[model samples]
Each structure stands twice: as C-alpha cells, then as structure tokens.
Target: MPSVFSALPGAVLDDSGLLHLGSPLVEQRRLAAGEAIAPLGDRAVIAVPGEDRLSWLDSLTSQALTRLDPGVGTELLVLDPQGHVEHAASVVDDGETAWLITDRGDAEGLLAWLRKMRFRLRVDPRAADDEFAVVGGTRSALARVVPATPAGRPLVWIDPWPDVSPGGYGYAAVDPHPGADRDWAEAIVTRDEERRIADAAAAGDLVLAGLTAVDALRVAAWRPRWTTDVDERALPHELDWMRTAVHLDKGCYRGQETVAKVHNLGHPPRRLVALQLDGSDSVLPVHGAAVRVGDESVGTVTSAALHYEEGPIALAIVRRSVAVDAVLTVDTSDGVISAAQEVVVPPDAGRTANIPRMPRLSRRASAQ
Candidate 1:
C-alpha cells in the first residue's frame, strides 16, 4: 500500500515503500523547529488487549513494562535463547490496551509468536496496523496536524533514547548527548487522520518530512533501529541499546541469563561506533558496507547518512578488539572513505560482578 505521505507533491518514496521529502536540509530544519512530521510507513501496530496484557508482556520481553502508566511510553525487545535480539517494539498503553509499534516486516512474525504464547492467558494479541498509522515528529509538530481524541489527548509514544532509564545503563561517554535535544515522538493516528494530516501538509497548512530525514536525525542521535541496524547475531550491548531498551534488574525472561552473564562476566564481542566520514569524496556508503582497518575487514556499516548539521556520518559495528583511536575506512562503490571512530560502547563495557574471593590455604600448613 502506498504511504499516506505519497499524496504530498515532490514526495519520493523509497524502496521500502515509504515516503521521503527529497531534501534532507530543509526537512532537518523543519524537524528542529517542530514544524515537520513523517509518515512512519516502516512501522506497524499491534494491539494487546485483556486484563493480563501488562503482566504477560512484562514476563516476556526485556523491558519492565508491567507498571507502564496509562499513555506512558516504553519499549521492549524479544531476545532469542542465545541472547540475540529477535524483535523490538515501542510500547504504550491507553487505559485498556497495550499498543506495540514495530517494524512492518516483523509484525506478522511477532503477532504469531504472541498468539502462540496466549495459552490460558487473558491477553488477546492481534495486528492493528490497518487501523492505525504512525506519524513521527516532535510532540508539537504532531499536535499541529493530528486531531486529539475525544478525551482531548493524542496518542503519542515518547522515545526514550540515550537516557539511562530505571534499571538501564548509559554507555555513551558524553553528557547532554545530541539525542537529549531530539524531542522525537510517534503518534498513532487513525487512517483517516493520516490522510487528513497528509492533505494539510500538501496544502501547505503544515510541514512534512520523509523517512530519510528521520533516518538522518536518528543516526545523529546514535539510536539503534531494527530495520537497518540489527542482524542475526546482534546483541543489545553491542549497540549500546541498554540505555533505553534493556533493564538490567528486570526479572527473568527469555535471554535474561545471557544478558546477566555478558554484563557481569564477559564483554560484548562487538561494539558500536559512530564514524565521522571524511567528506572530501561525495559518496555515501550504503548499509552493510564493509569497514576496514589497514586492509583487514573489521566491521560493517549499519547505517550512513549525510546530516544537515554534521556532514557525512555513519554507525558501524566493529570487533570489540578494534582500537578506539583507529582510523578506519568504509568501502563504498565510489571508493574507500576515511572514517574516524567515535566510541559508543567501549571495549571494556560490562558490570563488575560481586564474587568474594576464597582465602588461600598455605602449603606449609597443609604439610603440618
């Protein structure tokens, strides 16, 4: 299905069948001014309804969501038995239903899994993508276009990135991170509301942005997304996702043992890094581009974007052994572009487990 944003003039939809406004700089400025909104075609909705929805979800995912307040936002990650991320969702609950916003490609599989887990539980899981369209922007931008519900509140899921939420950890070195200034939120609008919002933007009554603009801003924020950033072997630690997604003290769930073991005993085998690409050459490395150091492949680019403020930048996952000060290069079809590493997750990032050392017995005493 065509995205609602497609109705706007000069909107260029991307291969994922999503909309892009064709100009990053203009869109970025609009976003900063809270005058821009993007149709999140890549995102879908899942409705979990029933008396046990919150508790059941709490027992199943990485985040502690049982106490999620009404209309409050949170996120969840489903990890495999091996501690690899399987699915991720942005979560919000309206008094009666838990709304899960996830990647469109993962919605079906996620819904199927939820259904299988519904045995004897009071939760009813079903896909609600057709009913709701996700529109992302700052809270103010959404208010300008989307109408409020009968209760006078528009449904919005606030993004909790780069912050150390309860039971979470911040791995970034710098304070007042760029994400702190990014007032990113996604509002769930009805299909008619989406069309109305698009029509308003097209008629110049409101400003509109595309997915590329959102991607560029997200890259700058060091936000780890599921579509481009995740792979079969990806772990939350590598992407520094624990800042918002993982709760270290959360009760046992699938992959909890590995999460605890890795945090306390082992460092993640790979670490995520932000790359300042040398902009001498006008080439942007596509996703999955190889990252190399001294002719050896050490990592792969998960995402790359030409920011409105920052020039060419990228996020890459490299072997944890890679030096923080290493001058790397990204292999693009145009040529190799020099990249300077900015650490997201440090090589030694992990918890210090409390284990009392046993007192040693002297050999002389044993002989006596």
Candidate 2:
C-alpha cells in the first residue's frame, strides 16, 4: 500500500516509504517539543487474538505477559537457545487482542514464528500491516491526532527505556540515563486516519517529522534498535536490553538458562556504548563501521546520527575488555573520526547474583 505521507509537501521517501520532509534537524526539534509526529513506514504490526494470547506469549517470550493488563504497554524479546536476541516487539493488549509492533523487515519472520509456536492454542497471530500504520511522536501529540478508542482502546506503545521495569535489571549504572527525557510513543492508526494525518500536514494544520528526525532522537536516547544493534552474537545483557525487555524472574522460556547464567554467573562478552563523535568533518559513521582503540579494532558502530542538541552521536557494541576510558575512533568512509565513549552497558554488566564467597583459609591452617 502506498503511504499517505507521500502526498505531503516536501516529503522525500526512501525505498521503504520512510519520509524525510526536507529538514530533519528542524523536524527533530519540533517532534521533541511535542509539536509534530513522524510517519513510521519502517514499522509493522502483528495482531494476536484469542483467549490464550497473553499466557501463550508469556510462555514463548522473555517477559511476564500472563497478567499483562489491558492498555498497559511493555516489550518482549524472543531469544535463541543461547540467549541471543532473535526477535523483539513492543507489546500492548486491548483486552481481546495483543498488538506486537516490530521493525517492518522482521515482521513476517516474527509472525511466522508465532504461528508455528501455536500448537492447539487458541491464539491466532497474523500480520496487520495492511490494516494499520504507525505514527510516532510524544504521547500528547499523538493523542491530539490519533483516535484514542479507535479499536475500543488506545493502541499506543509507550517506550519504557532507561527504566528498570518490574523483574528487570539495570546494567547501565550511569546517572541520569540518556533516555530519561525521551517521551516517545508509536500509535497504530487505520489507513483512513493515516490519510487524515497526511491531509492535516498538507494543509499546514499538523506538523510532520521524518524517519531521519525520529532516528536522531532515538540514537541520542541510547535506545538499541533491532535492525542496527542486534547481531548473531547479540545478547540482551550486552545491549542493556534486560532493563526493559527481559523479565529476570519470568518463567522458563527459550534461552532462559543463558539469560540466568549470564546474569548470575558470567558477564556479557560485549557492551553497548554511546559515542560522542567529532563533528568537525560533519560526517556520521555508517553502521557496521569498525571502532578502533589506537591500532586494533575493538568494536563496530551500530547506530549513528546528527542530533539537534548533541552534534554527532553513535551507539557501538565494543568488546567488554575494552577499557572504559580508552579513546576510540571509527573508520568511516571519510576518515577515522574520534569518539568519546559514554558507557551504556558497563564491562561489569552481569554476574548480578549475590552468591556468597567462601572464606579464605590461612596459611597456618593449610600447614595444620
């Protein structure tokens, strides 16, 4: 389906239909101020409807969803047997249905996995991208334009980042986390509502931002995204994702052992960091660019953007062995740009268990 946002003036869309309406920096400021909304063409929705929806999802993912109350927003992760993140979604239940919002590129695979997991369960998971579109902005901005009870209740997924959710643990020990001020939410709207939003923007009644602006704000928030942050070896602990996505006390699910083992006995092999890049060259390093410590490669940049307040910032997944104070550089197409690291996940991020250590024996006792 064609995006209704494509009709708005100054709308420049990428192949995936994400809009960059001429001025992304300006859009970022406006969106952050709760004066604009961004059309999220890169997002997709899945609908799970059945009596067993909540319990079924709880048993399958890394969250305690069995008692997920209506209209309460949370997120979940599908981990591989090794506790590597395979899929993730922002979740919200509207009593009768559970809406799973994820990156558009991963929606089909996630939906298929959900369907395959349903063995005689009353749950039916199906793609709902054709029926709904996502609009992202502050909660108040979204409320003004989106119908609150379009589907009997608000279908907004409020981000719960930088917060240690119930049964979750905080690894980023930083004071005043970067995402503290991020008031972002994504609202699921019907096609007709999408058109209405487009019309309002076209008529100068509503201000619209673009994916570029949205991403800038997200990167500044130290928010780890599925497409940019996850790799074959990516673990929830490595990205500080356990703070929001994983319930440490949740019942057994796929990868629960690994999650417990890492949190209780071992530290994550890698850690996520926020990099303050040198803006003198005005070039943001692209994703997957190698991060270097002096002469050796230490990590790869995951997400990078030029922010409205902060000049240029990026998120990188570096080896946990890398010194926290080490000066890092990114190998971009332009040149090796220097980056000052802000720890998102510290090197000592795991081993959260309070196991008591055995008292040491004295040398005299050993002789005896």
Candidate 3:
C-alpha cells in the first residue's frame, strides 16, 4: 500500500497514445453527433416559466444563479444553518429554464425546500427528466464539435464532455419552432455524439472519473464536497469554497448571517491542510488515523489517495493552532507516515487572514 503513491517524473505526453475504453472506470459510452453523455449525480431539471425563476432559485443557495447563462454553468452550495454545506449543484440555465445537477439523493430535498416557499409565484422548480450529456478533455468523437482548450494543466472532465465554458462561457439551446415551449429550461444531453466525446475523454489518460474519484479529487484540491466537507457543525468560510459558492455582493439569504460573522471576525475551530506523507511507502493511512505532533494529537486524515501523479497525499482537518509548516507523524498500520501541512481551510476561513500575528487562544493540542 505504501508504494501506491510515488511521484511521476516527466511522464510524456501521448497525443497519439492508444485510447482504451473502460480503463479506470466504466465502459467507454458513446453519444451521437448532436448528443451528450448522461448527467451524473443527483440532478433535477427545473423549468422557470414564470417571471420569478431567477430570484426564487437565487434566494435558496449560496451562489446567485439568476444570471446563469444558457450555455455555461456554475457551482453553488446549499449550506446548513451552522454554515456547513448541505448540497452542491452546478446550475445551467438556457434562456428560459435551468437544470441543477446534484446527487440523486439530494434532488427531492432541494425541490421540496424550494416548493415550501411557493406562495403564489410564477416560477416552478420541477424535476425535468430530459436526457442530458456532456463531453470533456481535449478532442471529441464528434467531428462537428471541437474540444475546448484547457487552462492550467492537461484536462479531464468528470462528466468528460466537450466543455463550452473555459475561463467562463454561457450558451443557450433553442428550438427552431417558434414558441416550442422555449425548450430551453427542460432538457438533458444524451446524444450519441456527446457520448463519443465523453468516451474519448475517458479513454485517454484523461479520466472520466465516477463520483468517487471526482469527490476524492475535489477534497485533494481543497475544494469541499457538500456532504463530505460540510455538515450541521461547519461554517462556510472554513472551507474556503467561496469562489463560486457565495456572492460577495448578494444580500440576505437563509445562512448569510453565519457566513458574514465568520468572514469578518472569528476563529474556525479547525483548519484544513494537505498532508504529503514524507516517506514513499505503500502502507497508506486509514481515514481515522490519529495525526500526532510528537505526543499531542492535533488532527485526523479526512481524505487520502494515491494520486494519479502526486503520490500518496492526504487531506486533514486540524486544530487551528497547529503550525501551517509543522512536521507531524500520522500513525498508520505500517508504522507512521511522516506528514506535513499544505495550506487549506480548517473550515475556518479567517484564521490565516491576519498571518503571523497570533490571536489570543487556548494552549496548543499536541501528542507524540
């Protein structure tokens, strides 16, 4: 197990590499020229027919989605009263309607929550069963649809569909027939072409990972997943997932008070950090292993993975006082994995804002 994560040095780019279907995941699924791979997770398509769709949906989640474009999408988190995240969804609104892709389990809860406030409004958040699809990575099986350029590094979409949004983009799928119910709000992409693109993306070293791999990647990247990173006890700022989860300028919402107080001032009891196991061995630490700083226990490894390229890396939720650059040992079955911190939110967003200057607090928590 300790040998699982060893650094990859100069792994060559294989543009012409053989595309193998069903490699690290499911079989290579194919979609026709004008289609897409099925939408994954708990997704409910919403048709905002009345004048209040945007405002209605916006008032419920962490991000303001009234302006979500026809083609592109953005991620939003529905946080609990304690400010911890509850549900996460990527919303896509064609000119007239919107589709929220979340976990299948979360679909009904979200729908019912919105319906509870339906006091004579024109908008309706219904579960549209339209087949949906997407393509990701560099190229596509659909000759007509070109693969979008990737930013930062080599690409792979969880849905693995051709992404139309790079650095942000919006689109609308309209019907040729006038007043064809505006076909904008209630559709899913499942065309064969879309599938092919998804297939190709998955086939290449580019992985079209299932929810498990995708979730692991999210936590590793320090991006919080709704259920995993959030709960009844967490606060929003602690996760540092603000990029798309919150609107800095938006007014009051259900959990805004908690968000505001945490951001402005306060210490999040915990901090998030990445643990790079010092020694390269196959024995990986289990999820609940105690991370020790000498004799005092300061944290626990929350997520661990033998990265495709980065080796055995773990994400831990630690006490705020634990030094950001502190060296520690994680007790595992294979003796101990020497681990250290890679800056991530401790679920406490503001703790590090006033860096170096110490805050008045309790004595440190340490265990050998």
Writing each residue's lDDT as its tens digit, candidate 3 over 186-206 gives: 124444433554445445522
Report the number of backbone clashes for model 2: 0
| Candidate 3 error regions (>4 Å) | 1-50, 128-130, 133-188, 191-220, 278-283, 286-289, 331-335, 346-368
> Looking at candidate 2, what is the lDDT of residue 310?
75
Q: What TM-score, over all chains together, does every model reach? A: 0.92, 0.94, 0.64
Give the best candidate by TM-score: 2
Worst 10 residues of 1 by lDDT: 359-368
The total of clashing pairs for model 3 equals 52
**C-alpha RMSD of candidate 1:** 9.9
Q: Count clashes in each candidate, considering only residues at least 3 apart in sequence or on different chains.
A: 0, 0, 52
True lDDT of residue 12, candidate 3: 19
Q: What is candidate 2's lDDT per residue for 225-326, written digit by digit as tens?
A: 898899999999999899899999979999999999999899999999888887463688988999999989999999988878777788999999999789
What's the ranking of the predictions by TM-score, best on top?
2, 1, 3
Question: Candidate 1: where is the Cα deviation over 4 Å?
Answer: 15-18, 147-153, 280-282, 352-368
Model 1: what TM-score? 0.92
Clashes counted in candidate 1 amount to 0
- Tens-digit per-residue lDDT, 107-128, candidate 1: 8888999999888999999998
